[model samples]
Target: MNTQIKGRTISLRLVRKEDAKFIYSLRNNKEYNQHLSQASGTVKDQELWINEYKNRENKGAEYYFIIERLDNEKRIGTLRLYDFIGNKESFCWGSWILNQDKTRSSAIESAMLVYEFAFKELHFASCHFDVRKKNINVIKFHKKFGAEITNETNLDLFFQLTKTSYGDFFTRNNKFIEN
Candidate 1:
């Protein structure tokens, strides 16, 4: 699916094969890899992974997006949706703002765009994520989006956000004015 989500500071587009190097660099960051299930390595490895990701049937897997700075179109992060076990729900995962110099707001904005896409465009009943337990900032960030902890493993916390709750959050936040 050719799709794009525009945020105040960034735009998210489907991951392209051309993005292998950029993605490899971001995923190699020790801080970023701690939260990811798989470790990423060389550009060649990233290319192989992208090939598999692109060919996967949408019947189960949904979307994977590349987050880019709107001003200069520099690739910075990635967002993925998968594990569509049913019609109403799916798993959401992303790594944003790999640039250490960037503000947290950029990552948050990218996530909000993905959330909107999942709940609004895709019509998912709920979107969920598994975050590393030690990632306090991520847990708090998910909470800001009204996600609740549903389950926990030794190293991860599983969180869920229902469509209704997402709508309510936007209502209360009075529309996200992207900066």
Candidate 2:
């Protein structure tokens, strides 16, 4: 697979071993990490995890990406697509975090690129993911992008966005991602 998906202002590229520190910083940054799963261990541990993640990435099991600015190549966020279900029928994406000082469009462009890669390149039928109830902003963000809440637990809400719905979203917001 081509490891990089480019958008107008931001791009998603495969995470590398060298990205351990960046990833660690984002996960440990209190401003951004509150809604995310707690990441424990040192940067060395993160590197070890990336080593294993590389193996899975090579096997087409999962993908982790670094979202970076086009003009300066500065990484601003991270997200992953994994937990595929039912023979590529659906995939779950999480570990999404952005810098507190990130560019205004990084979040939107990163999401557009992810869905573009998933629906167009990978041919997935839908996306499935869960958001912590505390992450209200992210929940609203996904809803605005056409994801529907299918289920919920006490702590999290599960969402599903079919490719068809994503097509509508893409059409409505295409200009934001135009090259």
Winner by TM-score: 2
Q: Pick the candidate with the highest lDDT.
A: 2
Q: Write the per-residue lDDT of candidate 1 for residues 1-179, one digit (tens) a residue.
A: 43778887777888888888877877777767766777646899888888888777344376778877777887777777777757665656555435653434576677778778777777788887788899899889889889999999899999988888878877775345354
Residue 54 CA error for candidate 2 (Å)?
0.7
For residue 120, model 1's alpha carbon misses the true position, in angstroms, by 1.0
Candidate 2: list runs displaced more than 4 Å: none
Clashing pairs in 2: none
Residue 58, candidate 2: alpha-carbon lDDT? 92
TM-score of each: 0.87, 0.97
> Tens digits of per-residue lDDT for model 2 on 21-124?
99999899898888777889999999999999999999888999998888888988899999988877999999998886567888888888889998999899
The local lDDT score (0 to 100) that residue 174 gets in candidate 2 is 96
